[model samples]
Target: MDMEGEERIAAPRAVVWQALNDADILRQCIPGCQSLEWTSPTELAAAVKLKIGPVSASFSGAVTLSDVVAPESYTITGEGKGGIAGFAKGGAQVTLLDEGPETLLRYTAQAQVGGKLAQLGSRLIGSSSQKLATQFFADFNKAVVARAEQSVQS
Candidate 1:
């Protein structure tokens, strides 16, 4: 499956980039994120639980960021296994555009799944992926905006 989206955050590009890389911030924004830990400056270990259709499972994954151009863009790649439920692997290109006081984030991702999940068919998988992606970006934008507001108040 392929996914793409854009989000406008009411914060500077640098601030947005920092938030995206912060484990604490991501934990708040990502749905069902049990943990997000940085093993290295460019790598993160994460645990996520998800329910897709009738299947629910916990996934342990590692995400690596490469081709990084600070406050601008990076490539993220990761893979996760859900035992019998399935396994998923994907990569995404994320870009941040400075829009004066705000930042515009653009991302495109491609993912593949194996085992029982793939048997659910492409339509269901595609829609589920879209929904999850949408929710993630929405939550992330909200978190970033809230932080920006708090900064202004302080």
Candidate 2:
């Protein structure tokens, strides 16, 4: 499955980019994330509990950041395994564009799944993925805006 979207954040690109790279901020923003840890500068490990329709599973994953251009753009690739539930592998490319005092964040992602998840039907997976992705970005945008406001206040 493939997904793409853009969001305008009320913050500078550099600030938003910093938030994106912060493990704690990302853990808080990610839906169903139980834990997120940076194993290295470009590598992160995560545990997430996900519920899709009637299926629920805990997934362990690793993400690697590459093709980076600082506050401009980067590619994130990850894969997760949920034991009997199934597995997922995906990659997303994100770009940041300056928009006056704000930043325009754009992302394009594609994912593939196998095992029980694959048996659950593409329509269900597709819709659920879209909803989860939307929620993640919405939360992330809110966090960035809040941080910007806090910084200004301080």
- lDDT: worst 10-residue window of model 2: 109-118
lDDT of 1: 0.89
Collision count for each candidate, in order: 0, 0
* Per-residue alpha-carbon lDDT of candidate 2 for residues 1-154, written as tens digits (9 for 90 to 100): 9999999999999999999899989899888999999999999999999998888988999999999999899999989999999998888899999999999999998888888988999999999998888898899999999999999999
**Which runs of model 1 end up more than 4 angstroms from their true locations?**
none
Residues forming the 10-long window of minimal summed lDDT in candidate 1: 128-137
Residue 51, candidate 1: C-alpha displacement in angstroms: 0.5
RMSD of each: 0.9, 0.6
TM-score of each: 0.96, 0.98
Backbone steric clashes in candidate 2, count: 0
